[model samples]
Target: MTTPRRAPRRAPAALLGGATALALALAGCSTPSSGGSAAGDGTVTITVGDRPSADQAAARAIYDRRVQEFQKANPGIRIEPSETVWDVQTFQANVAGGTLPDVLKVPFTEIQALIARKQVADITDQLKEVGLADRLNPQTVKIVQGRDGRTYGVPVLPYAIGLFYNRALFEKAGLDPAKPPRTWAEVRAAAKAVAEKTGQAGYAQMATENTGGWMLTAQSYSMGGSIESEDGAKATFDDAAMRNALTLLKGMRWEDDSMGTNFLYNMNDIAKDFAAGKIGMFLSVPSAAYQAVVINFDMPKKDVGLTAVPTGPGNDNKVLSGGSVEIVNPKASEAEKSAALKWIAFFDLGKYINQEAAVADAKASAQDGGAVGIPRLSPISPEGFERYKEWIAEYVNVPLENFTGYTDNLATVQLKTEPVKSAQEVYAVLDTVLQKVLTDKGADVDALLREAVATVDTKLARAPR
Candidate 1:
């Protein structure tokens, strides 16, 4: 309900180092309950997490109002809002201690492992009963399924990596703002033009805080390479696609001199610079336009433009994707689980299917100085999404025409999830390789890939089987 400043844009959850201890702790307790208190008179009470903090008064007010409305509409269920949120460092402890709310949101990267550890509930039947199963995006929903093909969580806030450009820069460089680059070659030429004409960094790359690896992996995928094998037991990125990807970056940094002087960029630094008009183009989700350009840095909404990540020869137009999912307490009773599902449907997803909810949310966000109409991967079915968009059309504030390059190509670009095993570790390893390529003029791409293969193979060996 809030401006979506950061929840949907958070980096992947860090590696769960305490997973073994948490599993042991969970095993010791036969049944875990979210303390979803249920009364004998057929009334159920569920505790939900992710209530906005008090400092976010406007968003919090909307959330609290939704809670009250949900309770009043469904008198059979009472809602208790909790401010608990997912933090990699504290998540394991909360799960083991049974301190989590009945329902909470977590990143997609954590779903597979959570399902493996039996840390989240199987909500397949509840979803069907609540009529939410068919409403969801089938492709995105797969991320929350177990090997047995059962559901554990509901996908929300889905996003695919895309190229975000500064329209003002594009115009200043004598390029068409409506037509973004669709291939790597075009991107290179455009970056050079922006640099030569505007005296700004034509392009930038994220080079630290594990984002270096993240963006590099996305680039490699776009060039038709993968980071791990099918079962995620081996490193598989030592190939020509990855090599060429790095080679391009190396050339951009040293030969073209278009990437600017600063080589170290995490999510925040990159967003900040991009908003300040120091950079021209970069890879990120469309949410960055709202979170970075408008809300954080006060960039004019009309100046931001978004398009699909450019494809390479063998890419088939696939782009990396990730987002948030709502998981329920594995220890909850059936009644509690049902109540939790209903709450999720009403509070998290009401906007997608209900016109009133959609307009109310968008109006509030816009009025509160939050960005409206930023493009995102639809979590619901296509038909549902189209209707939702129509409902909010009047309140839409961002420049939709500037994003036609992405929205028009959305149907063609495929969405790929991140690696399934030791993802953070793989990213950490790749960060060094990307940094080397960008910062060291003579960095050897082949040698870097070979060394990474050896290091990542070792990481895969130590990962839990």
Candidate 2:
């Protein structure tokens, strides 16, 4: 069934223009006090970010209703909602100028830096007081914890990078739609078969800008390689895992000729083409790519298939993961912090424990024509997630069977976050290395990797301590 598209759950960064936002933040214009004010009558007022814009009527309606409900439940707390979202260009400016909301949503990648810079509040005590600490998924919550083991944010929606394939294309190529490739060897064979049979790009890799590096890191992790060391002190991609991954891609491009002629695919380009049935399989976040394909490009819902990242020589269950975190302002007053955490727990995390919330959110999303119950790595424990699924089963709109390859394998998956130090710089360097290997048949993988290592090491060295 064709469904109308809804605004992404985590609003895109484009809601506020970058340059304009940076200027406004730096100028302290429209800046709310970092520490929310307390009224004489004991009302704790906290401003929250990511309030859906009016254009997204359904989402905004749900958000507004939730705000009203939260306020009604907690009579001593009041919410002042804002449309401000996390934009890379404005994030630093906002932090420096103290223009941030008491509660805001940020990506997992930024949590480490925010923690190091003391720009986010430590909520270890708060989480415990609310009895949320023990209920959280230990692995998923690690992304928002500091080296000191203090929790700084609440993980909302965690997801692992997976392989997105076209079931229709698989059928056309005489491959099993239910059993996607689980190993590199199988991927190569499947790509060859799909290419030979359907004359389309059997498999494609993103090779443009940061996405090139992002996918390269994901591929390396799937093969048991890491891009940076644990402490972020050194580059670690110059190992056997990385070499093996590149070698496989080189062979696919040069020998199997399964990859399409295009070697400059970004996230959008790859998703567009994949939806058009020009490509068979590629790596991406299933839900994100699903929206691009089924919503924006009008691909049939039954045609999309999402599965875990195929294992390789490393044979480990490791895969890359990223998600959004709801963090309290570092400068928020104790009262504000308490209020903000309560709101986050109610508005963002109540679904895992509250059946009413789980069903309400699912029904609202489904009514808005949003994909509900797409497979994902949950922020809550396995038991909690299962219960949540059961609670919302009646409202789920996405085809559950199409996601079994991902959902059924969650027990064995180990999620790793993006590189912590100089992540963007590291991605930029790897982007060059990935593009060189994909576009040039004679490219020397070792030499390219060595150069990338040197560049990333330099970046890591110059990074803030």
Candidate 3:
């Protein structure tokens, strides 16, 4: 596999304009209505909305299958599933207008916004009564709780970022395919060696536009850095820990030359290149393992491996978790809300549904003789774990359990609610700071960071709540 050296072409201007217009039109479609009756009898129809994903098509099939099972068990109950675009503002607009589905799938970050607008129901007691509260990951549960300590939703699945490596490249560089780097130093060293020996980019980090800052945030958190204070009311981008993280990334571009010269190669391109055997290693969600494993029907399977994101000098182990939560609308009737909760619980505990989905995801990768990561829940099945272990043993040398870390709940929550009208401005300042450090050589890291921090602080202060 080789990295696609050419930059991705931009979307046509007319297409871009049309997309903007469509988004605006959808936004305009949201308009509030007078309060309606809240009665949920057997005839009540429950509407649910969720954003589409690559796996969602299959997940939806599984969900519908379960719905059929549920309906068979309880006659007269109907579940209607709707698809929505993945945009917070548009979703909020629907919520404000009372046009939202009775139950909606939302990113954990958006829960705060929903809470602030009184758009979602408080499920704290419901969860306790159902005995599902104790089953959730505590870190995930924290993200769904309101400031007042009431639970609002349940997470169906959780995803964390990690390192995706190409075994062929590692072997070519005389590095052990079984042993991946654990610290930032090892990552740089191994990547540099691979780049030099293989004559291909060793690693690629997302440094283009707003994503550059997002990648930096992940790296910073892994180094025990925080972008804001504990309460999220204060900025801390200028702190030594963050500066150190930035310094290390800048060093990668300048000293090691392991990263691509251009920063536009995001997670998608990185996965594609790794699958094509063009790139050595990169940061990506665990799901990338599935993509790589399924890249080509005839491709040999000894190409990909998965491990936790490399550790930093201070032993900080963390990764950004991205997934959606299922929230019931406040306007939903008691019976509708109860039905929604039951559906959520059903999906969460549907071991057959989950296991089948996991197997399908893994088999998709296995077609290329590549491996995929198992969901935390799927490990509960003895047969599932045995199959997962066999698939993983084909490529990865290190134990997957050794690389896991605490998800950054604080950062996830802050980014969700942080007032920032200009995502571009915030990203630009941080990118400039990093570029200067990497290109100019020992370029007053402190001053660069302070300027970036000030810019972000101002933007944060002015963003709409």
lDDT of 2 by residue, 84-135 (tens): 8887567778878988988988877778888988989998987876667887
- Cα lDDT listed for each candidate: 0.79, 0.79, 0.57
Candidate RMSDs in Å, in order, are: 8.0, 7.2, 9.9
Displacement of residue 22 (Cα, Å) in model 3 is: 37
Q: Which stretches of candidate 1 lie over 4 Å from their true place?
A: 1-37, 52-65, 82-84, 87-100, 315-317, 460-465
* Model 2 ranges off by over 4 Å: 1-37, 51-66, 82-84, 87-99, 315-317
Cα lDDT for residue 30, candidate 1: 19
Q: How do the residues 368-411 of candidate 3 rate in per-residue lDDT, one tens digit apiece?
A: 33333432322123343445445344434223442333122222
Identify the superior model by TM-score, candidate 2 or candidate 3.
Answer: 2
Give the 10-residue window scoring lowest on summed lDDT in candidate 3: 1-10
**Residues 229-321, candidate 1, lDDT per residue (tens digit)?**
866789999987788789988988898988998898877788888989999999976786457766777778788888889888573446888
Tell me the deviation in Å of residue 284 in model 1.
1.3
Clashing pairs in 2: none
* Of candidates 3 and 1, the better by TM-score: 1
